[model samples]
Target chain A: MTKTSVNLENPQGYPEVPPKTDSVSPIVSRVREVLRRHKFAYLSVGTYIASMVVFGLIVFAKGSNPFSVFAVVVQSTMFNGGSIEQIVLRTVPISLAALAVAVPARAGLVNVGGEGQLIMGAIGAAGVGLAVGASVPGPLTWVLMALAGGIAGAVWAGIPVLMRTATGASEAVTTLLMNFVANDIMLYLIYQPWRDRFSSGQPQSQPLSQSAQLPSLFGSQLNLGVVVALALVIATWYLLKRSHWGFALKVVGGNQEAARRAGLPISRLLISSMLVGGALAGLGGMLNFAGLEIQLVPGITATFGYIAFLASWLGRHDPYKVLIAASLFSAIALSSNGIQLNFGLNGSIVDILLALIVIAPLFLSKNRKALTK
Target chain B: MNGIEQTLIGGIAGGTAIVIPALGELTSELSGIVNLGTEGCMLAGALGAYAVTVATGSAEIGIAGGAVAGAIFGLLHAYLTVYRKADQLTSGLVIWFLALGVTGVLGTGYVNDAITPLPIVSVPGLSQVPWLGPILFRQDLLVYVGYFLVALIIFVLHRSRIGLLLRATGERPEVVSVAGIHPNVIQVVAVTVGALLAGIGGAQLSVGYVGTWFDDMTSGYGFVAVAVVLFASWRPLRVMVGAYVFGVALSAESVLQTNGIAINQYLLDALPYLVTLIALVVVSRRGGRKAPEALSRALTDVT
Candidate 1:
């Protein structure tokens, strides 16, 4: 047994050689290191192109010219005036939704409840808007509606926070489940007491008064909500990059035990980060409702929360990048309508494209250590 | 039969659909790979099976196609997580989004189509028994297969050497590797098999229960199966019971509505999710010592 025993460490029974360092030039190694460092960037671009090609192939398979689909999507989403306004309107909510995920992510928490929080925010805004739209001055009503929406989002987000702090449950699952609950709650409200009496058949609340509606900007279809979203993005960037609370959140996210040892209030930070995230999403919901919807209706959020989650991930949680990613997603979403109208393709084709963009980079790059973090 | 009896029977059938996926999830989790994309796999399976059934006019072939579709997605997940070392949760979510989009696009054609659903086969004399007969004996072939499969899983998990090795691989992959086996292979197999079961569950939902296909028809049952696995504490018998409990909760609204009970439909729709949350809270508070050590580490941020 001793004679036949194999050394696992050197199973091949080959002598070790060390000549690689001398053969390879220092400049070459330096170049290699730089390439490796920028590998993810290259992979991201490659994946994006690959995803577009795949989408083109899918369109081609469906018997429509791939070039036409691309042309239609871009022309409809960007070139057309009405569609451009639609894209901007859509971007506002999506940007906020992305911010909602980005904030909590800075605290190392995955808040998938943005959808629920967004819904709650819409409900809160609508509740406030309806109650005071007829009585209070328009400006005050809008302010109150925004505040109520923010508070509702915070409260909705706060439930999972409390659950996480009290019991070590996964916020991902809880938040996902809570979205359904929020939808139900909204459904109950719209169907029962909030039903518009004059509307007859549709399940929706009455339209907000003219004063309650968000004013258009510069005589265009664009509204004040886009400005609000941009301001919030800048504020989020400042908070994440330059504030004591943000620094504490980064510390907490990096290492919870280290933060605790450093005397940071871990629970409070977690709760507050989530609350802020919820508030941002809520604000987005309010802006969306007030600016575009002008009334509470079923599917008001319309998966903006989920799309925002994707945008945040694509942006790597950076506020500026999230804004860009949100805009890109909005373009894709808006273009889906054009593809459906022109090529008879389903609107969900955009989902496949988005999923491919996210997944294809994994296939291109070997370094996955970034994902675990 | 009375409304109570009808409700009970319907609950059993509903529960059976959930149980198949829950069992599959339990298997995957036991191997330390949490596939959150079970819902996606189920959707793919539902569409795949429905399509095949429509094309070939054979329910069995449709079921097989569904399992194959699930296995393909499972392989994708395994490649991303086990080979590429991508984050399991993120990979699962990506796979889900992929399935959702693909199915939504392809399944639009089949939305209005119908197929001959799997017929219920009652046991000869036992099906005639007063109360328990219809609930237990009169069920589709898949339900009976599920029962046998559960029993087989219990045996394999508790009584077989392979089962012990699988459990060991999940708990301590390093140890398994040292003992001359690749743990990754085991993990991949477990996940693929688990996804296969989830797909079958989806097939059951479309063919055995609904008899029709729709876009995203599995809804959140795959996620519910994840919760059900937790609710069962990774035990086979408990998984069966938990699935039925969820099934009952799901069917309660329709049963009440059918019986002329005026309830807010949305509230009933929300019950299963609420129950899942409550169950998760209660179970977590009680401490999850029964969870595989490596799986707990995989899921939670706590070191």
Candidate 2:
């Protein structure tokens, strides 16, 4: 009995390993494990709450009802019918942009040029829609405009890809730099002689014909673009999960060396990834112009490409998840009006909050063991 | 006196905005990380300084506040990219978006009113010196600091022991770690310094060049800085030359416009951007012949 005393430590000066115990249900345990593993997830969600509370407190300090303000945020975004429509309308481009990014992200590529590409695409679509407002039939005109926009976006993105492949340039720099080029080009269009003749001195483009506009989904401002967005999501989900080309894309993403070894066309995949991504963004531009404003404005995109990047990241490039993330972002943008009315906060704060929510996950995962490896 | 001089002057002023962010980015890249958030940091610095200037009426305080704001953004970027190992591109883009959105909101109050800009301080005989005088000496104090910073950066990057360590870390962190130094610590410092410079640069734009701050005032100067870094080939002297060259191109549009010349103002405004793009193509086309060996991995990988 004395010799049978339990050993607290092994001879190696480490604690004795315990024997396996009863396992929790796989499904339930997995859910708990994921939540536990990703502390950043909780932290990010908490950041959303904390930012609101802090903003509310500041509002109160400035002489307002913090509670009522908070209530309004929830009510406008979540419960109101008109507000919900506005949110959905905002989600259209963002979701498309997310898909644009996610399509390439699956191949382990970063597409920082979404902002530029989206704008270029919008400009392209607007150009076609504006130029051919009454010449072509409505449906044919819409298709042509969408295709033109997508092609322009692809071409814009193609320059960086070609450079990266041909000269070993960093796409990050090139893509970013291209953004300015695209912006300047757009500015030149809006400000120079190409400026809409109707606006005496202002810098804006002519509005598209009423027939060029995408029909509303119902009585709301939401248009056929939402349907297109949903369709793309479903198509993407299927392609990624079930198609061979998607498999090839995943392989390319997993490891370039391995993909090369397996005789996969790495260069083709790289260029195509960027092309498709750009095309999607361009399609988003068409939707935006056709469904929402029916015109091109200087700040029309309003950084939707970036918000899409966040959505893609939050969704981890999964189509279903992208849908959810896009919807959430749209809600945030919609609630911005409420936030402004009640708290005197500008709508841009919505972007700030969205960004914080998007990136805050990093802080909470600082000590993760897997990250160390 | 002519279009050339006007373009040259305008370019010099606008180019100042690109310098700090480029320097900061150069610092980060040299220390083994690429900050995508330079755009955001620049915006934060610009807006922060503007907010401070309006509230405090001190350009120095505004610049300082801008630096602080930039440093905070840098720290956040470092913690995410370095510590948590979050996707560098992801964190950077997020930061950029956050800055754009947040700063846009905070910047609304100052949109209508104009703040007093920094007065020019000439350096005596240097200010009177012919072509060089107007080009180099007839600007605010920040302009002089820009040149001094370039020289200092060159000196520090080449002559100091820490510089060697930093360069080595940028090339290969594993090698640096084997030598028993903390790569993360060095990277954090590099990022912070880079961000600080960027903030100062941004402040110069709103306070030194222009008399007031407006939303989106940066107009992608931060992005131009990235191109500048590439154009410079990671060398300080070359960066100075490149920055000035970009500056000249920017000023060209204004000079042309002011002269009553029949030119497309938009096309002129687009020149710097187009030139930068062409420069990038030309530089990149030079291939492995000119690129820093360490950058090979970064160029191919998305992150």
Please identify model 1 stretches exceeding 4 Å from their true place.
Answer: A1-38, A200-202, A364-373, B290-293, B300-303
Q: lDDT scores for all predictions?
A: 0.85, 0.78
The superposed Cα distance between candidate 2 and the true structure at residue A316, in angstroms, equals 1.0
lDDT of 1 by residue, B9-70 (tens): 87788888888888888889898888888989999889888999999998888999888988
The DockQ-based CAPRI class assigned to model 1 is: acceptable
Off by over 4 Å in 2: A1-66, A192-195, A199-203, A365-373, B112-114, B177-180, B288-303
Clashing pairs in 2: B7-B251, B11-B247, B11-B251, B24-B194
Candidate maximizing TM-score: 1
Report chain B TM per candidate.
Answer: 0.96, 0.94
* Predicted complexes: DockQ each: 0.43, 0.65
Model 2: per-residue lDDT, tens digit, B125-173? Answer: 9978888688778888678778788888888899998888888878877
Interface RMSD values, listed in order for every candidate: 2.7, 2.4
Question: Top model by lDDT, which number?
Answer: 1
Residue A62, candidate 1: alpha-carbon lDDT: 71
